[model samples]
Target: MSVTRTNPALTLGKYVALLAYLLFALFPLYWLVKIAITPDRLIFTEGTDLWPSTTTLDNFRTVIFQTDFMAFFGNSLYVSLGTAAVTTILAAGAGYAFSRFDFGGKKIIVAVMLITQMFPLLMIIAPIYKIVASLGMLNSLTSLIVVYTAFNIPFATFLMQSFFDAIPKDLEEAAMMDGCTRFQALRKVILPLTLPGLGATLGFVFTAAWSELLFALMLISDNESMTFPVGLLTFVSRFSVDWGQMMAAGSLALIPSCLFFIFIQRYLVQGLTSGAVKG
Candidate 1:
């Protein structure tokens, strides 16, 4: 066998490129936090400065205590978690069915879902608004949750189906051969393997619902029911904006998404090997 040498220069170049890319991507988030901590008086004066001459926690303090921020936060939390949980469960079931079952109209059903995604939300928002209004569900968190779940399910189902497709059907077959019912085999043998898929779907749906502004803005008129994205607009007024407080709130808004990813990150890892199975 011939030995080969590694290219140190190429390796260094790759690392340098990756570092540059990461800095470029994360710079905006850094700026958000930077503005958040900077005192209000210096916001316009030192806007371009990488670091503020002076910083304060007053922005954070005000966002947390001086406004209806907590109510908005709680409303968003409830809607997002409710949407994510409902969407994930429904998607999981539908995905498994699509993956394993050969049913009539499977192709047609999939095509319909794909078609639904093709139309922009703006195109159908009016009809949706009319329906929700007729039901007297306007300005309600539950309505937001329901609408979010409905809109998210098709894409979420497709995402989950791709994950299910990645898993081998033989695992379930083997479990069934040992006398487990289909549902039992699915629960005991298949679900554990699909943890990565489940985690990813949950994360995706949660992020989507959490950041959604248009629907929340349209459906929720009541301040008590507003989600965080809508609530953030309270910082803006007829003539001015509260930059420090707005940035502080934006920075704080990132916490739940970060914590959620942290919680599911382990399940997001793929390629855990088992000696019992050979591919």
Candidate 2:
């Protein structure tokens, strides 16, 4: 057997480059947390300081208690989770069908889906708003969920289709030959392998719904129904902005996304490796 060797100098350089990239990427997050804890008065004064002379939990406290923060947070969470689940389920079924079946209008349907994605959201916002208004869905969380699910399904279907493509049809066929139904074979053999794809689709849909402001702003006029992104605007006034409280709220908003990624990170890694390796 031959031993594999790596250049120490090259390895060190790569590590240094990776470290630099990480720092560059994470600096904004670090600054967000820093500003969240920094006292309001000291924010501008100590903005450039690596460490604040003083820090306080007052911003977090006020945000959590005195404002509509929790309500907005809850609204955002509900919409995002609802959208993710609905979109993923529909996308998975559609993807599997697309992958396994040859049906009439298959190419045309895919082309339409692609076309839908090509238009800027601005162009369709008015039409979407009109449709929602006609349906009496304006200012409704359920409406937001429905709209998000619709918008996400096409791309998510394509994503899941790619994952299904990576998996061999022979696996399901063999299971069917073993006296299992097609659904059974899918559940027992194929679904488990598609976990990475499902996780990725969920992450994508969740992030999309969570950060969506335009549709929410257009459809939701009520203060109570406003999602977190729109609610963040409350911290801004005509004359001045509440930097500390805004930053605090922004920092808090990142928790769900981070926890979600942490939960699915393993699946994401598996997806990367699954693409890299071949039989």
Candidate 2 C-alpha lDDT tens digits along 1-279: 854898899889999999999999999999999988999899888978998999999999999999998999999999999999999999999999989999999999988887777788778889999999999888999999998898888878887887899899999999999999999998999999998788898987898799898889899989989899888865554214678888899999999889887876766655445423420
Worst 10 residues of 2 by lDDT: 270-279
Query: How do the residues 192-274 of candidate 1 rate in per-residue lDDT, one tens digit apiece?
Result: 99887888788878988999999888888888888999988754552147888888988989999988778766645331121
Which candidate comes out best when scored by lDDT?
Answer: 2
lDDT of each: 0.85, 0.87
Q: Give the range where candidate 1 is weakest over 10 consecutive residues by summed lDDT.
A: 270-279
Q: After superposition, how far is residue 25 of candidate 2 from its true place, in Å?
A: 0.8
